[model samples]
Target: MTIPLKLHVGGMDCAACATKIENAMKRLPGVTDISVSYGQELLSVTLDEDRTSRAVIEGKIRALGYTPAGSDVARTPANDAQAATAPWWRSPRGRLVIGTAALLAVAYIVSHIEPSWATWAYVAATAIGLVPIGRRAIVAALSGTPFSIEMLMSVAALGAVAIGQAPEAALVIFLFSVGELLEGLASGRARAGIRALMDLVPRTARRLRGSEVETVPVEALQIGDVVLVRPGDRVPSDGDVIDGTSGVDEAPVTGESVAVLKEPGSTVYAGSIGIDGELQVKISRTTADNTIARIIHAVEEAQATKAPVARFIETFSQWYTPAAMAISLLVIVGPPLLFGADWFTWIYRGLAVLLIACPCALVISTPAAVASGLANGARRGLLMKGGAALETLSKVKTVAFDKTGTLTRGKPQITDIVCLAGDENDMLAMAAAVERGSSHPLGLAIVAEAERRGLDIPRAFGGSSVTPGKAVTARLKAGFVSVGSPRHAAGKSALTPDQADRVAALEQAGKTVVVVLQGAQALGMIALRDEPRPDARAGLEKLRSLGVRSVMLTGDNARTATSIGSLLGLDVRAELLPDAKLAAIAAYRAKGPIAMIGDGINDAPALAAASVGIAMGGGTDVALETADVALMKERIEGVAALISLSRATMSNIWQNIALALGLKAIFLVTTLVGSTPLWMAILADTGATVLVTANALRLLRYGNRRSD
Candidate 1:
């Protein structure tokens, strides 16, 4: 049987370090799949349990000088807290740097008095730093990864010592260690954003049981239990309110700027804060499955799924490292042997080139930007599945939207009622009795209006059936009654010129007129219209400004589609079935990549067919699990905001790559000309790695303001 293992890894300061661990672990006997992400500090592996156990796999990782935090079988929150809260000076890496730096300081002070004593003093400092680095390099080589950044630093420092440049060797090790410290600090900022989300849920909740209210751990609360939230308290978990109306601030979870007025039956997420009224919220989700927890998990897991540019960089670095080493070997041998040039001078240059080829910044450039982009998007409620989705979304040229619930307010109320025959109440009761069982949006709208008027609808019909996209008819005691579209009414019943003209006027006015017929004689017409959302027009305008075309596809008539389309400045594609929508997605693909946004089950096929599928709802289960992108909050403007975010993330990644390679290229030229010293090469490499990391962090502030 195959079993999977997930462990939090430590000591991975660069993307090249992750590659070294992955290469060493894949050679284990039964390891089938392995992924190590330095940005996430995660090691995920799958293997056959019969051939290899968790201990054997973890031993391989340990042999590569990477620490694997205990597996799920023995892991605890305290273990993580201990590792995270521990001071930097207490760790082995920190002590080595401090000791090496202290020795280098003592040697510099002593060199002014006696140069002979300072020579060995610098050797002692270099030896102290080189011992641990050399041991790790040997262990990495034995584990099948001989070309790691550690191996490069170890060889470069040792070569500098051989040429009697002990001072330069000591300073090189100190600077390399300092660079690793800077990387750890920068990566922590990205992880801290995710930790802030996890901290939003209160550890304990106030659960209400009958007349008594008990305060217990959040994990102790189960589904169906009600909890009381007082003023200025964050919600314990995801649930629906049973009583009390409050102004809830959801900016932390959903990024809605203003406070939302949440009443009874309104859905509340786990991290939102409650103000004013005390709300009794019934728990609907478990502690581990809450909204904030899922977002954190998704963002961490997304780091392991590399984007195309990241994968390309990783592949390029594989050959780039060894090729640089080969060139360094040639430089040391060709100059001294052929021309009898000074051996010490050429060998020093060779070591400088090797240190310049560390590949730390080049390897980490893409993943750091991608991880920051994913974390930034989650903070604003745009949950992208992986880097692939984020990259693909940046290339979307057209956005296809579903009509109902997507571009408009999903709820449709009865706007106008016309009575052609009997009392409006009696006709409404007949229509409500026929439509109470059906789940169509129009039918539900009619039934809701009848119930609001306090009409008693009796179950006086049987053998009810729907005519596909047309009306619904049923067999009653007196005769058959139907409440369907005007087209369905025109086919079965004849209407006089005046009544027909009234229906035409309503249809032209963008009202979905459902004719109520009693035994083939028209009783009246009830006009229903699903109004456009308040932000719908502005969202399309934003998309237009970004050079993305907007179009709406619906099963409604062309007149209605055009009315709503004109209001929102969108092209209308109406009367499309589920299969027709799928075809429409394919047809749009001919022009350019498209993203299909929808909230209903029928939109799934079209979503899958598009370049990127964006599920739009109030974070319902169907929406969360439907597509590559899930919009938890129903903001039509969010679609444009996400597109802007994707473009910004890609731009950040390009800037990182240029900084990494551009610095390396400049130092490579100087090292070849003998103008740069050995220690300066290492300093340039360290500076480039730190600069790359800091640039990628800029994406975390994206979408926070309109100007951004």
Candidate 2:
């Protein structure tokens, strides 16, 4: 006897808004269940054939301040016109009509005017309001759909009219409309946060070709094309700097407040604003693959994916609506027929039961809880892409982390330089001269060290050539110089026994020792290794306490990985390739839910394939785009906080759902047995909504909770 109904609902803008609509629909007597998605602007409801008509469902939505499009009420064109012409509540003068009816009811209730005249006036005002608002409900009930919430309200109003109690009818309709309007307004505001993120990407870009800058659509900019960005302009594409240098304000991308200096060879992201310089950048990614574009895609996907509990509500609403309507009809009509009460009065009461039985409350309970949870997460530095990710995070039993940038400070510096046969000054001078022409991070560190020591590097060394994972060889006035890894220099037998021993000692300490030699003899060994981030140990301990097992995965060799793992007290150490890391995550996922934290291009695949992937804010575009959650502040403590927050948010959502449904069940039982009045129905519907909303808001304190 249950019929499925899909409605396109307007005025929903966030998860919270979707919750409000779902709740409002569930509260209706005939509605069995409901699902509302703010991202899709869609609402699906199930209703009982014997108890509710489509008109009642539509009317309930209208009362809550939403226009239901494509429902059986057949107001599609009118709804579309209303959407185009004015706000849902303001259009068709529904609010004004309800207001006039309300004023007349209030005057009659308080005045000493002639009772007969007051009754007639109230009836006339009710008729005026019902003609526009309740007409659909009346028609739907007559059309074999019977017992909709709207029909119930209409029948009650007409009964009041028939019995000469016009003021009551007007009051009921006016109050219903007020509730609808409040729900609509609340839903609209909740969706605004996600919409704001979408607004950051510009639709166009300016391409600089042969000194001519021409504006083109963002999608048309191909890789290798040069794009010109002016000061105060947002980068329309992700690219490498080809010309010019400037400070870029990357707050939108990294969530940091400071502007980062950008010189030649620096990388820039889409949607980041240029603060002080013009830039000519060679596009590295297509518009579809750009940072902002991927962010939008991820957020959209997240919003569309329902949480597990949300899916249950969707399935529940599919049947709950129609079943509730039939039960309400049986409750109202069967008892009276057996007892031989007046048929009309019994039918009227049955209709009241139907109106009160609408499933508005049940439909919204879960979604509102989700919206509030997501918003609260965003407010704290954790950006949960969707309900699914939020749900996954809560259930994660194992957390895997990438070592280099995630656990240790990504930028390692030269901590020590050991001289072998030569004096310290000579060894450093030659090494710095060779490294000065190289661009590797280690080379940069050596150059910095030499500069710090006030050693002048001769300019006579021609440009250097670098071999990946090997060494940088340069032509210097003294001779051909090489500064590189120990393996590369060792192949040439450049180190003496004493110098090799010294380098071995440095390497054993988990430092990357670079040996500098001019062909035959060892010069000196310079060690570089990322220091552990200050919060690394504390964060790891927190995760352990939370019962989430922690593992460290790194591309670094076993020695380095083992050293870091031991220092941080990780339960497992995985020194792996990108594929090995991904396999490890998949294997872990087989046992239960797992979360992976990484921040490199190599980590992108694993990050995407994990149950939950968290990326550092300053990580590569691929990693950031692939991650489900982003830690805006690159700190290990934030990772622990994110996990804790996710668990807390999920708990809050479940609690809200339980409370909302529990209240509804109690109300339904009481109403069915005649222990509750029509006024009680109104209070339960509205009051439960308020309570669910308040409960969901508790997620706002997720991160700040010390024990959590």
Candidate 3:
């Protein structure tokens, strides 16, 4: 059987490392697929477990000078003792940083104090610093990627040493080590946010054992285990609040700042803090099955799916490195052969050009930012499918909304009742009797109102018949009664002009009016209205402020749709059938990219028809599957959060791209004109990579200001 495995592989420095590992693993028998991310230090592989073992895979990575960390790797007492007694120079990265700093200082002192021995001292310094950097370069060369940044830097530094510029060579290697240190540190910090999220889940949980409280590992906690969460304690797992009430601070998991009140039935997720009360929660999920764990899994998967721009860059980079190598070769041979320039001068200049054009910074720019963006969104309760959805959301100029479950709560209530014959209770009693058997939401609302008013709602004696999406009819004590939409009821029941005017007035006020009939005579009108979500107007206002135009698409009457739209300051397209909503999306797409927000099986087609479909309510399987992005939160504000998150992510990606290309361009031009030295060129390339990565990590701060 084929199973997936993920390992944290250390020592991946550039995109070339990922490529090298991927290429090596693809040749292994029974390996189905592989994905490696330098930013996350993650290696995910699908392999036939019966045919190959993870030990063999780790062995292959170990041969390439990378350490693999996973569950199967056991720690021994001897290894622990060695780790504790390890010296400052035990860590290759840390040793390189310290050695480079010491060597650079020595080189500077010797160059000024003793000119005669300065060259030898500088040579020693370069050698000391080049040990770690040059080894990786050689490994990369043996792995078939000889044009990586490490390789380019190695070539440039050695060429300087051969040309009697030992001080410059030492400085170049020193700066290159510094850049690697920075990149490693930045990547570590980026992964730390995700690690911190994992840390929020306590290692052990307090579980009930008859009369004893047993301290057990969270992994040992199973579904239906009752766990106690004390005041100011993090919930051990995702479960229901069964014994106590408190305010829960879900900010760490869901980005909500205020503490939400939890009762007997409230859901408490793992990593949420129970602020002021002790609670007993019945575990609903296992340790690995909690919401936070699922979020982490989703984020890791999201990072693997490349953005459109990242794919283009990846394709461009396939030839970008070799093209850079070719250009450097031409720069070396072309100048000396064609222009009669001095060999050593042109060769040194060519080496500088090679280092300047390495493309490491440009290639690393997008995914780091993309990973950070995905992490940011996940922390905020917004599950962006991947960078592709985020990229699409950034360009969305028009946002279309479904009225029923999106803008308003899907639950409707009977708010107004008019009787043409008997008292209001008699009309409601008759209507509720027929509607009680109907499964429609409006029907349920009428029945609930009758129950709320203490009316004697009777059961239907005879068999009831209902037209789908129209009306319900059943035999009552008085006569055969029909309760349904105005048009549907008008066909089966008699309507007076005065009663018809009342229905029209109610419909115009955004109330969904259904006629109640006894035999052929219309008894009264029942008007129901689904109230707009409390945050609907505010969320729409936020979207408008962000320059996203809002449009309301519904199958309701014009006056009702207009009333809702005007209240929310949105463009209204009333009386739209499912096909009309799809056409509306296409029409909007003609002008610009449009996103549809919906949460119904009927809305699935329109959701799929738009540029990006954001599924709200998360109730139906069809809406979840059809939409591009599914919102776990049911509020309209989640739409605004998504838009804001997308804009920030895309903006960060562009900034990184521009920074990378801009630095490379300037340094490339400088190297060509003999203004930029080998050390400075490598520094520029390394600095740009570090800058873009650090800038991308800024997205970890996104959505921190979200309020309750």
Q: Which candidate wins on TM-score?
A: 1
Assess the local accuracy of residue 442 in candidate 2 as a C-alpha lDDT between 0 and 100.
83
Candidate 3 per-residue lDDT over residues 1-708, each given as its tens digit: 898887777767666668878877777788876888775567888989788888888887876657786633322223323433445355566677788889889888987898888999999998878776677677656656666677777777888889888888888887877787677667666666566677778878899877789999888999999998888888988999888889998877766667889989988888999889988899998877787776666666677788999898888987888898889989889988998999888888888888888787888788888888877776666766678888889899999999988898879877778887878898889888887767788888888888988999877887678877677888888888888778876675478677778888888888888888787777788888888889899999888888889999999888778888888889999999878788888999999889999884668888889988888743233433457776755667888888887888889888988998898888888888889888788867789989998899898887666542
Worst 10 residues of 1 by lDDT: 72-81
**TM-score result, candidate 3:** 0.82
Better of 2 and 3 by lDDT: 3
lDDT of each: 0.84, 0.69, 0.79
The residue-by-residue lDDT of candidate 2 on 404-514, one tens digit each, is 778888777887888776678777877888777566778788888889899878653557877878888787787877888888877888876766787888777788899
Question: What's model 2's lDDT at 470?
Answer: 87
Backbone clashes in model 1, listed as residue pairs = none
Give the per-residue lDDT digits (tens) of candidate 1, residues 1-708: 888888778877667788778877777777877888786678888878888888887776666666777665432234445666778887666776797789789878888788878878788888888887888788788777788778999899888888899899999999888887777777777666676677778878999989899999888989999999998998998999999999999888887778999999999999899988899999999878878777776777677788888889989998898998999888888888999988888899889989988888988888888888988888888888889889988899999999888998878878899998999988888888878888888889989999999998857555578888887888666578888778877887557778889989988879878888987898888999998989898889899999999999898888888988988889989999888888899999988889999884778888899999999865577766778888866788889888999999999889998998898889889988898898899966788888988998889887666642
Superposed by TM-score, candidate 1 places the C-alpha of residue 252 at a distance from the truth, in angstroms, of 2.5
Strongest candidate by lDDT: 1
After superposition, the stretches of candidate 3 with alpha carbons farther than 4 Å from their true spots are 1-5, 27-32, 46-56, 63-65, 71-91, 105-115, 276-278, 414-503, 513-526, 555-562, 574-587, 600-602, 618-626, 703-708
Deviation from native of the Cα of residue 532 in model 1, angstroms:
1.9
Candidate 1 ranges with C-alpha deviation above 4 Å = 1-3, 30-32, 46-63, 73-83, 337-340, 414-502, 514-526
